[model samples]
Target: MVVIAVFKSSRPEGKSAMKWFGAAQQRGTVMALTALQVVICTVWLTTASPTPYKNSQYITSKIVYECAIGSVAGFSMLLGYIGLLAAVSFLLAFLARNLPDNFNEAKF
Candidate 1:
């Protein structure tokens, strides 16, 4: 969703703006990037720790040590990516504020 929003916000006005990258290309790019994001998260979470157990005690490892550290790191990285995308989107939108709205409803 953020990827799509960034692309839409950065799109310039005029017929020649995105002559080579039409709607199809935009959709493809978004889909590809979304898939890549999913893969990255999946890989990070799945392979985060060498083993789920911290010590020989199964109860302690499973109950108290349930991937606390790895999950935090993974989520922090995810949050960083989201924050970066948001910053880019905000910058693009601010720069394009003077341009005509792409959606007619936006003028209302």
Candidate 2:
């Protein structure tokens, strides 16, 4: 997402802006980077020593006995966070492209 934000800032000279970020190799590169990030996070999570909090018998409220709820909630939160980042970055790119660079300059 940060890569897309930085890539969108420059104006294209001879080619379309899509070509700048959407190259055939770029898709693979982005996927690889994302996977690498996830793997690193997973490694950290797996290697970390758990604290003495025995409360983890219930990741969520003790009222819910189904463990699936906790996993589902976590998955949803992750997806929502990723979606929000993409949406906000795209919105910023849109505003950057359309808004006037300088408001002080007079047309009249």
Q: If scored against the real structure, what TM-score would every candidate get?
A: 0.55, 0.33
Backbone Cα, N, C clashes tallied per candidate? 0, 0
Best by lDDT: 1
Best by TM-score: 1
Off-target runs (Cα >4 Å) in candidate 2 are 1-23, 49-52, 55-92, 95-108
87: Cα error in model 1, Å: 1.5
- List residue ranges in candidate 1 displaced over 4 A: 1-17, 49-67, 71-73, 101-104
Residues 1-108, candidate 1, lDDT per residue (tens digit)? 333344554656433544546688879978986786787688777877334544546564454544445666777777787787789778876765654456325543
Reference-based lDDT, residue 99, model 1: 49
As for candidate 2, its clashing pairs are none
The CA lDDT at 64 in model 1 is 53
Q: After superposition, how far is residue 78 of candidate 2 from its true place, in Å?
A: 11
